[model samples]
Target: MTATCLLPLFETSYVAGEGPDRFYAWPDALILPQKVRGFYVGFLTYTYHKGGFYLLEGWFSWFIVIWTVILLGLMSIGGYFMFRKFLKRLPKEDGMSILDWEEHYINETRHLWDEEQKQLLDELVSPVPELFRDVAKSKIAGKIGELALEEKASKITEDLIIKGYIVATPKRDHKFLIKKLNEKQIDYSRYQSLLAK
Candidate 1:
């Protein structure tokens, strides 16, 4: 804790503000000792040590120590709140695993297929062994979700039909063109024309 005297016993000044000059003066100078305690009690004593005239003096005063302590406390509180605000502004981890994110994407797009379409899809993959059909369907659904999320295509039932995952029933007039599932690969040619528009 550092201390500074707050009282100036003698002060002289000249002022010229919108008028003739004005002069002010005080004849005596009060000097405080190099050390004092509890000066903020609002009263303190000093001594006039000028011209070899040693005279004790008393005056009202509030020291700088009190103001310094008050300012430091306010600054500390402000700093704490600022640090908290900075922490809140930082980005937070999402805590979602990749598989969880993929499942969430799948769930969001599941409704794109109508009830009839879903039933047809179920029937299409039914030829796989019962134990493996669910796994195959899940893999297919994951692929579909991936494509949809990439904005390449949304409805994959036609792709599956083209790929022969869904057996095409014979039509009376039109011959169905089917490629075997083993030969299936994602063909973006169909979407290229749509995206060009």
Candidate 2:
């Protein structure tokens, strides 16, 4: 409601011998009386200063405000340490995150991919924007290189590049991947098994 419609309520805030007398006479509508009572308790309980200003000049108010800040700082520091400890406990291959291993694998197999595989990787990642295309190609190559190292294969193949492209793409972006696959006239049905993974 506009301020004019609410003028009646705002004009009724009268202090009696003990407390606000206006809140006691609100219409007994469903839950409205309780809401008005809550509003009165929230505003009237705080003693206001004169000059129509809302400056809270008191020691107790300052103490509570400072204490809340101190507690928030303590909680944030504690939570950070707790998260670090938790991350340290998860099992890792070579004691590194996935991104680090991807880089390592990419370097290890950098010499193994023939020119054909390199061209295929470039084509597969072309759908990505120019800004992120290099990063996307590196990640896809790393994934394909990782599988080669796992199987101890001597070189990368068309199948490995295609599978890695699909696997590296997030599920949310699979539609774009499918569109790219269709544009290239590659049969995506053959990769349904990898997509299911």
Candidate 3:
């Protein structure tokens, strides 16, 4: 996210009150997060009790104002530096720059590689079941499409459905089936024979 967006996430203010009549105020010095929009915005507010002016009649009144100012100044300075540091620490998001795109691409590629490896490993260790083989054979019959020798397509597809990849429908269309297959990143023809069954 941009510093502009992060600015408002750190916004804060203060209020003081004793009863139905209350007071609110904000710092005199405003600190803002950096932005490429060429503008900075900060907010403040002041509220006074309906009839509490007498509360400020003593020497403590000046002390309260001075203390508030000093506290706000320190907070402003601290906020500026802290936000600058936070921005530096933020992980980059997509679309802002080429580096972001490259990072995303690399991560996607690695994930795909890992998935393929897992699939291969699973295939090597487990034998295809007989029901799946029969289903695969039936599915390939009329279309003249030859099924892969893996012969476990039905079981695999069933497992995928169980895992939430595929959904059952009362009516099926070839195009919609293909679209769902694509969304799952499965090879289009991989299940063609199996599906016929």
Candidate 4:
């Protein structure tokens, strides 16, 4: 596992953040090293001359190593900026990422949803914007499914779905949820217990 600790150090030394290289290299770097020894990179070859590592293999290998390093550095640094530019960091709930929590319930109880509940779910998420409609529907459905499992209910129901939607939504988005509920003529008074929270 010496390569495990050393490869990324050598690769990322020229980069700022953990680049795609980290993800891309692990399958080979960490896994192969367990089956082989010594520093074995594709382009970055090393020699034990004078008891020090040097890029003195040849002009071509030297250029390849330099090119690879520069590319890795740019990608590692760019990945962070790209993350800021593209991805939205969802707030964690109960000390877990929202996406993680979403997968948990969906994996556990997705079969609990019947065709009627699925139809109702489509209607409920109808008012959501097209871009986020899928996420909203999945979140609401995941929560509903989670509640059904928690309460040991045999099947999902309208009340369970409504309650799950409220609990799954953040307080800031409640206005939209409330507005949609009003448009759909769903009563919030019955969910007064959840609303008060």
Candidate 5:
């Protein structure tokens, strides 16, 4: 013997003078659940009511019941197969799970690494040997992190230098000018005449 359950997906009720006047005149249908021969059955009760009193009540025609059963069965089967397929597509433990790596590493440093940098690091570390991949990836990520920090530091330094020059601070301005001249390979002799003035 098998036990079945009745689950109501939708239902609505209206008391006399509590609902819209249109609902009172409209024919109402009640879908009730029944257990028969170990299977749950849906019985539709069509009722005609006037002034909050039922004038007539009868079961739905056989054609409607047959069609409803067919549709429900198809929907149930389709939902079951879809759920199975979704389960099969989930990440499995075979040692090549990106989700595992992401959960372990990326989730922690998400704020530090942007999508582009992460993609670049992945591209750089992908061709490495499997034994060294994790180490290589970590090294690459660390290097990228250091580079970003250095870039921000240099920008701050440059801004400070510019502000110093704007304020006519001789020491900082002279140091930056000298650095620029050295980078351009310009001889100090070229600026000696201006300095002499």
Candidate 6:
């Protein structure tokens, strides 16, 4: 565990028609070394005015800020470790296996079809222009169904490939796609071309 220093906080108030007035609180003036016995722990402090401690010691606002910062820092660290573990569990994409057309298709249309018998007929069809902006619009609408289908299926139908509806590639196996993704370092468009046999 690392130590963090928390400094004192100040409070001020101002009237709409008047000027600023500073309210000095005891807790706001105290600073903790943060590290105690090799571990960092935060504690509240009380201040004495002139002679003794009273009911009105310090502003509660400072206490809130100090604890909030500490809480967020711990949460961020936890989140980082959780993500690291998730990355470790996921399968690495290499040449032929890099293509996730089937998974992508399922995810995109999961809500529309039953899990047991999901099919491509549920997807809406639209023409996507070769231009980047047009293709992006088509993708957002989930209209590239034909292309997605061809990317994953082992056997491509002659009618679909001839109509420019699906992408075909020389590399048919999942390993080939994974290998291409890893060894060739090609972009997604390049993958589409490579698959478009």
lDDT of each: 0.46, 0.64, 0.36, 0.65, 0.44, 0.38
Candidate 5: C-alpha lDDT: 0.44
**Candidate 4, 148: how far from true, in Å?**
1.3
Q: Give me the candidate number with maximum lDDT.
A: 4
C-alpha displacement of 21 in model 6, angstroms?
16
Cα misplacement distance, residue 160 of candidate 5 (Å)? 69
Instruction: Provide TM-scores for the models.
Output: 0.30, 0.50, 0.22, 0.47, 0.25, 0.22
Residue-pair clashes per candidate: 0, 0, 1, 0, 0, 21
Stretches of candidate 6 exceeding 4 Å from the true structure:
1-5, 8-62, 65-102, 105-197
Query: What shift in Å separates residue 188 of candidate 6 from its native position after superposition?
Result: 42
Q: Give every collision pair in model 5.
A: none
- Between candidates 1 and 3, the one scoring higher on lDDT is 1
Please estimate how well model 4 matches the true structure, expressed as its whole-model Cα lDDT.
0.65
Alpha-carbon lDDT of model 2: 0.64
* 2 versus 6: better TM-score goes to: 2
- Least well predicted 10-residue stretch by lDDT in candidate 2: 1-10
Q: Residue 19, candidate 3: how far off, in angstroms?
A: 24
Candidate 1, 65-157: lDDT as tens digits: 456568889999989967865654455578654445546656877766667656655755665679667755655565556656666455646
**What tens digits encode model 3's per-residue C-alpha lDDT throughout 39-90?**
5333222223342221222355445556667989999998996776566445
lDDT of 6: 0.38
